[model samples]
Target: MDRFESLAERRIREAMERGDFDDLPLAGQPLDFSDVDDPQWWIKRWMEREQIDTAALAPMVIQLRREADGFPDALRRFDREDDVRAYLEDYNHRVKQDRVESRFSRESRIIAPVVDVEVTVVRWRELG
Candidate 1:
């Protein structure tokens, strides 16, 4: 196996020698990376390119944050004020539970704040 090349590697090397990769689009041109200031830029781009949903790949805390952001509009789903309060309370409970459970894991380092149920209830009233 000393001088052997895998089939994929051999095909790639042969293609390179034949200049098959030459004259390709964007060859030798500078990449447009002006928007790479985000630390997770590559991951975000890959997800976009592959048509993957961010929520599918995100952890529970991140999903919760997303849910909280759209929750005000979602409050309309509950016809009664008590239902909204219960939903907000359940959301807060999940957030707190995640915080406690992730205390020592990598996700623990994420600073996800728990949703305030009272403030949300007030918001729900305003929406009403």
Candidate 2:
């Protein structure tokens, strides 16, 4: 797992151990990301709702965004179309597999908290 995934997993384990979402006021509330698709969007919402220091999570958010955008650039750098297609296909397959595992893994429990913190930190880092 990458940094974001590792961090997310850790946060989820911590939350489950505590039985409450740490540092997030909405821990007990139902979460719906249907309208909020972007990591940054969720960060802002969580910050506003939780009234916490958003700066702390800025680096993680930027890192996650960077990773999210990485595959396309990686594929584009390939010299051959076939190579690019192969890379993309492999990437997609890996992503799908990870998604499936994440859905069933305990680490997924922390996805929301990790995302929330990441966005807040990103905003905070930008301001600083």
Q: What is each predicted model's overall lDDT from 0 to 1?
A: 0.82, 0.53
Q: Which candidate is the best by lDDT?
A: 1
Residue-level lDDT tens digits of model 2 in 8-74? 7888887779877566776688878675767588767877888987555554334344444554443
The superposed Cα distance between candidate 2 and the true structure at residue 113, in angstroms, equals 19
Off by over 4 Å in 2: 1-67, 109-128
| RMSD over all Cα atoms, model 1 | 6.9
The per-residue C-alpha lDDT of model 2 at residue 28 equals: 80
What value of lDDT does candidate 1 attain over all alpha carbons?
A: 0.82
